[model samples]
Target: DARRTPPAETEALLTEEGLGAEFVPARLGGRLTRADLLARALRPVFRRDVALGFGHGIISLFAAGAVWAQGDARQRQEMAGLLLGGGRATILHHELAHANAILRHEFTARQSPDGYRVGGRKDVIINARRAGLQVVYARTEPARGPRSHSVLLLDPARQDTAHLRHLPRVETSGMRGALFSGLEFTDCPVPADALVGSPGDGVGLALRAFQVNRSLICGVVTAAAGTVLHSAVRAATEDRAGPVARRWHKPLAGVFADLLACDAMATVVLRALSLLPASAHVLAAAVKYVVPDLLRENLEELATVLGARGHDHASPEYGALDKLVRDLPVAGLGHAGSASCQAVLVPQLRGLAERSWFVEQEPPPQLFAPRAELPDLDYSLLGIAGGGDFMAASLVASADRTAALRGPGAHLGALAGAFATELRTLREQCRRIPPGAAALNDPAVVRLSDRYARVAGAAAVLGTWEGQDGTDPFLTDPAWAVLALTRTGQRLNIPVPQLPDGVQDTVLGELLRRHREGRSCDLDALAYTP
Candidate 1:
């Protein structure tokens, strides 16, 4: 339970496994060919420990994401080489500011006769002390406009040691194994070629990188939630004959459905990064905002099942559950906070409400198919503002298709119709909001954004169900999808119809089967030896 960096042996093992290559592109001589597969590869690490996942190399991947999005060919090759060689890298932001604002960075880099002279301090940086390469965000111009800031790729090995200093490590209540520190540069000179993109492209590059990283990180953290749920299920099964245990069964089934819904949304967003890059910006933001909320709520419900044992760090049976509960919040706050993600959606709502809501074409079925092959990810296609929201369009189309069903799946049509109505209401609300008022400062605007995110999540679930080809029996079953939609409708405060008699039993049975069979709680359903 001690808060410290990951043990040296664990770090060595991760390095030996070449985990860093997951962040590098295959074209650049690394293993990173797809974003969804990268998340799948990182699951074993997150499932074991959130701190180890962060401490080992996620921060390096976060740093490399920006370079992958905007860096030149030489920069990409250099970063790929660094990670492939087991060297660490990190991104230095000025502060934990809102994602939508034009940040006036305190970290500045002044132009000089031959190069730039950097002089500033950035705090709360992950891997700051251990990083050999730093992607520093700094103000290059005097103005406060978007063009004033630039991202500089710095090599501490080449810098003058006397001018650069690493600050003390910052301790946290969770994810304690992560190395959180700061850096200060006093007139450190660097070559002009260190820039990742053209002058003033830092903010744009950062936003695009956030689009990819937010989706990837959220997908990885789902494994941690699954781990906690497994613990709760084990505890509940101990008192199998008790009335309390029986009551917990239905709630446990509900939570499992929530986890599957989260996985569906995250999986679709990750695949969308490659297949539908134009629509990924808003979809990424929505997933980042919604998935954590669902996972956190699931964690809270599971905590009730564990009772006081959930808090006992000394109990070997439940100690990991307590640690995961503490670590879950930290994962939510990383990269972008919930408010920042909602802020990203606020301004785009009006545009989407006007042009894309019901007018756009439905996204291709492959956009939602988890097993389908995708186009190679092109970071160049990642836009700062989404051109359209095909996911929402797909929801409307799915509702129409579901309404035609005549048998056991009939209730899903009503649930899907409720969500479609929710979308139409969201459109009207967005249309009524005054231009430029859809900002973080307005509580109403934030609420609208939240509702929009939930609706988008519903769309993800429906699209996933519709795209399935009966390969996985669990995914193809309508019981889980019905419960998933019902739970979402509850969150939206809509009057959803009562679920069929045996839907809960079917879902509960699957949850128990997965636990007994050593399969993952999420949709991948990969078998394990535990």
Candidate 2:
């Protein structure tokens, strides 16, 4: 109804509500101590409106992430104050051809007697026109090398008006309210203080920030999918005993299981950001590459139940589903695409295979808890390389525990044994890959990365189920777990037996129960008015 209203006002409202503090560091008088907690708070906004969510503060968080990772104490303090004061920020890191490939960046910040003369154009930056501060990654050296690039924190207000320009907003199929525009800087002078970290550390800092951004993307995608799923359920159950409700039993139940699995992956990865910072980067990429894909698939399945209401903007109550479908795909292309994230995991596969992946000890149970208090995110501890896969190891451990079950849990035990065999297959495939940077582009390598991601997601689901410790009645049951594993196995192309009839009925029943109660199918346990 208010599509004509710009995102600027909505952003201001969120700021007035003190959401800006959520992006600032706790040391700077904010509550950004944990990524998962912040994600929980932001999920509702993304669920409501994708454009407003990104335009409001997610763009600022992207800019703040880089500064938080590489900026000095003074720089971090200044950014925190700016955000705390309700000012917006944006990051300029990609151009037309080299979108997010920092190594091939054409932007330059040449040294001058005054400071640095920045010249380059950044395309499709979110909140470009309204941002008070812009974090730009530019090459400081004439030579072509990774060390040549550096990050600069520029105050657009201070730039020369004659040399700085913001291109017109780029219209899109969705999220049209965003101020998407290109930024052109021609010999724009920036002070020495604008430089973030050392001249050669820009790429490293950006990669570290990607770890945080990717995991956050998983959370937002899960939330958006949850909103759509809720609408689908309402549409299906509006006539509780009608054919629509009866016809969607199995399909809707399967979709709910996929939602839960994706949520589990998002939760584990977000918690890993604080628990195992070094390994978190690899896991983050896997979460980024896998969870969005799963959510996309789940949304497509829900569309069958939703029918025309998914595309019709005139429908009361469920019209927002149309916009969400358009907005979710953009998350896949932003910051890093699926292929790029998979590339991040390729080079490290061999090491993970031989050293610690499937053989490692189980990760702490708290890592899978949806409402657990996590430690503060330490940017310095985020590393590009990973030595182990704790989540996958947890799956291996759970399979052993389930194998000893005697009663109804025996069904889950059989499924776990099958998944363990799949893990062994993943291990052998990883071992066959020759370790080298040149092999990153191999089709086989890409396929392996994709499979590895599904395996990781399966492990996350297993860990979450076990982590509940029979406290949550719904999660402790093995029916949903069986469905989650089956869905994962389907994605991995691993042949698993059909779900038992009893398990199927139980899983389907839970799906209907959650829908009628106005609760999300994801692990967050959030309740909303349907």
> Candidate 1, residues 1-530: lDDT per residue as tens digits?
47465778878998999998988888898888878888899988888788888767677877887788889998988899999998898877753321211132368899898889999886567777788789988889988777888989998889999998888987767787887777789999988999888889887877888888788878888887787777788888875664335778767999999988988889989999998887799999999999888877887788888888888877766766678767766665433478678778998998999999999999888887767889877777888885899888999999999999877779888889999999999999988777874366788878999999999999999998888888888788888989989998988899899989999888888988898787888888987644
Error of 2 at 431 (Å): 2.0
Consecutive 10-residue window with the lowest summed lDDT within model 1 = 95-104
Report the CA-based lDDT of candidate 1 relative to the real structure: 0.82
Model 2: number of clashes?
Answer: 0
The lDDT values for all models are 0.82, 0.77
RMSD of each: 2.4, 2.6
- Full-model lDDT, candidate 2: 0.77
Please give each candidate's TM-score. 0.95, 0.93
- By lDDT, who's the top model here? 1
* Candidate 2 residue lDDT tens string, 229-258: 778877886856654456787678888888
